[model samples]
Target: MRPSSILSGLSCAAFAILPCAAITVDLTSEDSIKSAASTIANGMMKFYSGNVTGGIPGLLPGPYYWWEAGAMFGSLIDYWYYTGDTSYNDVTTQALLFQVGDKDNYMPSNQSKSLGNDDQAFWGMAAMSAAELKFPNPPSDQPQWLALAQAVFNSQALRWDPSTCGGGLRWQIFTFNNGYDYKNTISNGAFFNIAARLAAYTGNQTYAEWAEKTFEWTRAVGLMSDDYYFYDGSDDTINCTELNHIQWSYNAGVFLLGAATMWNVTQSDLWRERTLGIWNATHVFFTSQGGQAAGQIMFEVACEPNNNCNVDQLSFKAYLSRWMAASTKVAPWLYDDIKPYLAASAQAAALSCSGGDDGTTCGTRWWNNGVWDGATGVGQQMSALEVIQSNLIDRVQGPVSNSTGGTSQGNPNAGSGGDSNPIAMPAAIETSDRAGAGIVTALILVALVGGAWWMIA
Candidate 1:
């Protein structure tokens, strides 16, 4: 059976048990959102301190936690952008600095590069986030962040093996010792995003060119199928003969975001069209397929075959929501295609929440402790919440449009649509952004702690 068909069947089954409107879109105030963001942030911080960072208060664990860190940092940056909050910047900067301090240690001894695609990607993301914040009005020490990002770019660039696989990144630079082994869509997409973002920030056309080349290489190697679902890049021709066999949310998110960013800088119609296509095709995950929520559409381990639903799935969801929000900002015409999915995702997120003081529950159960691991599941839940929050804002405000005549809602600050309570919208939007940002920052710090704890255990 085609993977899409199989996923459709699974989703139908899951949705049978879930009410269509399980979640209410009543997140009307920024204060409420910010409060929730703060709760999530605190939970994340606790998780990091207890589990990932080896009981350390401020240090990062390593590559294992980098994905969560990068996601959280990205969310925080968005919060800073929306709210003009310097505190978010302060917290994010500190967390990033901690990661940078251990860069050399994380690098492989023999190759002087990152351990795997996740490391390169996450580190690259972290650097890009820092660069975005500091570039135009760089502080005295801001150059360090930009320089470190560039160094990571250089290291990751070296790991690209065009000869081994059809232009895909290796899973690792050293540890696996198999240079021409397995490749995955997430790796290539991530590298593409990192390179593209760096190119835009630096004004160097070379970075943009490299990003496009990597993107093309990914397409050529079968990481991306014609319909937009991704594949696990394995050389095991016997069991995994089809290149587009595996599809994951993160892969889609990374690829779509990368393509969009590249198009933004290069004005490449090819990239823009490809990104829009991927965005539309991947929307299947949010629909009611058969009867389930199509949650499995975001599964990544299909690439590894042995991998199962885990934290990465949650991470993928977070990435997808963020990508959707960001994309809507650039291409409002796509909002209608995206809004319903966001609504459905928000409902699913509400179901994931159980009764708690915070009103959000960790969706997955943790094996280590009969209760949810605060860092892993909690962060995932919060990430989903932020997406829901963003979607709510967009829907109520109406869609803002591009010059081509497609309309989407204007910025929340402009107060164009929605129920315009003079006192309500601004506070709600700002609070939501701040809360989400705070939670995300805390989650990153917590993931670092969780990684350390996991590593030591």
Candidate 2:
């Protein structure tokens, strides 16, 4: 009769001996959880060809941006941390190190064509995660994890455009890029996220101060609402007066972890309030559909229901699940409140992994009730992997700091002049600012000629 009814009758009995047997995970069993995570992790890596011959180590295939590949590695790092599985560690380390760029920042010249501040920060966040988790270090000759993160921070700090929107980072690093005039939540939220994590890991007050400054600027410019809902971005050309108002799960996730990290480092009431407020605001991403999928499962608020989520948006839920789990470790009290959402979402995400020829590939829609929505990609696999393994948050220790066994070296001036050379923009002078400069040059020439003739007279 109906599609759901037909699948329900056949998927369990014909497809498996057990009910809805896609990814069989037991919420109560650690072994079951890890086994299920391993399956999803393998399925997700099927899309990665970076380690093969003629393929770049740090790059994902086309239709996926360089930033997302960095994020995928972050998920893999979490996989190693949570499951103690070294299966993906070498590749994860390889990708992170290969993309460290000429200046050791994530700003590889190749990606400059489409790189945004948020893009660079994702790799930096991964490096920060490696330092905090003590993921096996690169050889002594390679760039250190903590130093790469600090380089990203230092470089972004210099690009923090006080020239527009009072103070906030632009979406694009180069003025020639399309979004250079927009100040988005992800860009600044990422900066704030890295600052808070760096502060906690390094015991540095300067990072904490930058965290506060970014947060306040985000609020003052109205990217962060009073109730803690984070919007997409704003047009800086209009002085950030108009907001995009499109809400995404990762935006909230980035700010939540940053605020939680601040609370962990400072133990201040302000950060505590901000942390709790953001956590509560994230309730919007969870929907409790009745029947088998009765729990509050997460979905991409802006794109999931409409089935229009792009490659990037498909992976947004992964980061939200990721940071939400990590936040509990930073703020232990959050463990109780956050545990149920992760559990519910993980189960639903597993159910959706019954797609592709292998029958283990994940779909974007988690509430599909064991029926794969026919979607399969690196993003789908990553989203499923992160949400599923996040159930192991309580099994491991919280992220370590420098004083607490972290060994990655730091460089206060690592990215001091990383901004010195940007790609030269061909025909980049078509703006009104350049047009005004042209008129001024003509007037200056006229004045110079007039002065010379008068001297001759």
Candidate 3:
């Protein structure tokens, strides 16, 4: 049988046999996966280009917000990485230059003073991408990109404190307070990602050490009762309690991607364990078994209620899609889990209408009776679309595993053998470790969820 026909036949048979209301489509083959990825990329590029050219006004009106700019820059790099399209790179360069301004006045001083740690972390992600593309041989002599990343890292790293319940990087610098303040999972995870990337590019052990310590802190303090869901912080105090209560999609996504990056750079068993733990956590939340049955049902209903949910779901799915794209770079098995979600999301996006040049759709606003706006909503749509594209391409390219599990690839951390430094010990050994591990093990217990399924398929 022809490969495509065989896949189609298998899909039909699986749907017929499966009892679940929703069946995920597996576009595991190279060509089909790439085609899907291309579709996503085209959609994302169109949306981004539109925003840039006043096609979508107010989407990003002047003096761009750093985080929003970071997201756009990240998406562009992602597009370039998966598709190898120079246009995306060109867009990234333009975006970065626009945000940083000129060399003498790069990254506004006032903006820098008011910047939150999460904002810096997000920008770090974008800067790292730019640095990677230009490092050791940048197109120009300007060091603004590298300097900005390093300054952000240094500023945050200097503020890290063990006195805090968790020993990860702090969330921001307080104007009134002299010490580091609140620390969130996203902030810490972003630093880990940035540090790992910096270590890879510059052979800096300081960056590697910081990344490892940050990951360890997350495992110690952030692992919640569910094991699958990581809390942002400890719930001892009121502020901490408030922050620690909810488990967000992006927090897990950023942490997993960071862990994977750390493992790529530093082949440490700890980082590998962290990566696997995060992957398991993400799979639990996103898939059926994660106790998010209502969420899953809601996502399906909201995106295409009876296959009709629109762009609102795309906003949420963007986080998952991007995470899955990054995860697939390290763990191809994840692509299987995300396949169905991607198809559903793409189907909904294709159906929704936008008045833009590409005929791409705008994101949905649930509160406004499914109204479509052209601001952050469009950005969210483009982000998700980019992830869908990247993952599909990755699926087509097949798996390219990094030999080093968590050790640095180019530069091992000095005196650490490429291992990240450990954080201060957890206040008390939480009971959730073993339980979390058990839950993770249970989620992957099925034969279809293992490597065997990928091989057979």
Candidate 4:
């Protein structure tokens, strides 16, 4: 096996055929593997019945919203990618097609509760996942998955309001929401993620510039605090004069993944520093189960105890889970150090499943030690699915060799390791080398042996 084989993988069914030696965690148990994966395709069905059954696939039982559905489908897409089961992929495409409005992008509503910038951004992230992972194409009239994401990027660019905060987007596109004044981290971070990903997939300098602009604006307004902890938004009630320092797991997560994507595109130390700072802040502030910390567990610090997590709030952890897993490539310097925490969370979540022969419901509170404490919902299932999938990403045993290509991009305030400093992208580095081909052309020389159905550590 060659060194490049570790990051290079081809689609088998719908997933990249990763070399098994790269895998770290052991999934020796047949039942654990089944539960972890089936929960994705099956649990998603819990929301609505099909055409004959009289319900939509993406919507919740009631209160249908684009953001939540986008999240559920996002995790499902990842499930197919991780497990290589087309069954997961089929439903994901079907659901996305249902939600994409006549414009070929997501525009579920147009009135007072119409799509917000953040809402649209979630679907954009999913489309990027589809494009980057090489998911199957959609209908001819509809946008290709990559183009679908680009539509969102296009729309968001139009909404980018430079008048207020120099270069940040507002929270809502609809003026009726009374939130137009607020310049938010989620909206900007979401845009940053989409732009950074598109830049990586296409090697477009334009997207990279937008990615950097979004990051700079986000930082300039103090939304992504000097500490790298993301605040709620800029104080629009006072004409953008003040700052609100409320942090959410998803806010930090959106930035982390965006920074990671930027790191992928430019390999800049700024992105690396930003990635490390936000990641470390996320783990430190949003963790622990029960009385003790116990293996770096993650929790929704804002609404875990009182249970104030709204429908939108419920799925925030899912982004954190998936993005943290995706961040493995950006900060490979911390990849080895990060695996145990992912494994610990997944193990706790797996133990949270409780039910009869019918099915199992994964809970929110993972620290209960086999106790299902939180109410089961689509968000809960998404959280469990993402965590399990993260651990399932085996990247350790692949062939190791002396090879390096990225420029020495670093962060000014990278504190976790202490030594990271600022650096610029090298001019000689080839974009082809930075952005590897989306499709690896099979050549799956080393198989994980047991397939996703069953696997060993």
Output the lDDT of residue 408, model 3. Answer: 15
Q: Taking the tens digit of each residue's C-alpha lDDT, what string does model 3 give over 162-227?
A: 554534555555555322355666677777776766665566666777776666556555343334
lDDT, candidate 4, equals 0.62
Which candidate number maximizes lDDT?
A: 2
In angstroms, give how far residue 423 of model 1 lies from its true place.
50
Model 2 misplacement above 4 A: 1-20, 290-295, 418-457
lDDT score of model 2? Answer: 0.81
| Candidate 2 TM-score versus the reference | 0.87
Report how far residue 178 has shifted in candidate 4, in Å. Answer: 3.6
Candidate 4, residues 186-251: lDDT per residue as tens digits? 888898888787677666677787888777766666566567777677645543445655567888
Distance (Å) between predicted and true CA of 146, model 3? 5.2
RMSD of each: 15.5, 12.8, 12.5, 16.0
The window of 10 residues in a row where model 3 has the poorest summed lDDT is: 1-10
* TM-scores, all models, native as reference: 0.66, 0.87, 0.62, 0.76
State candidate 1's TM-score: 0.66
What residue pairs are clashing in model 2? none
Segments of candidate 3 deviating more than 4 angstroms: 1-59, 62-64, 101-107, 112-114, 131-138, 144-148, 176-181, 200-204, 223-228, 233-243, 266-270, 284-319, 331-359, 362-376, 395-457
Clash count, one per candidate: 29, 0, 19, 12
| Ten contiguous residues with the weakest lDDT in model 2 | 1-10
- lDDT (0 to 1) per candidate: 0.49, 0.81, 0.47, 0.62
Give the Å error, residue 58, model 4.
Answer: 3.5
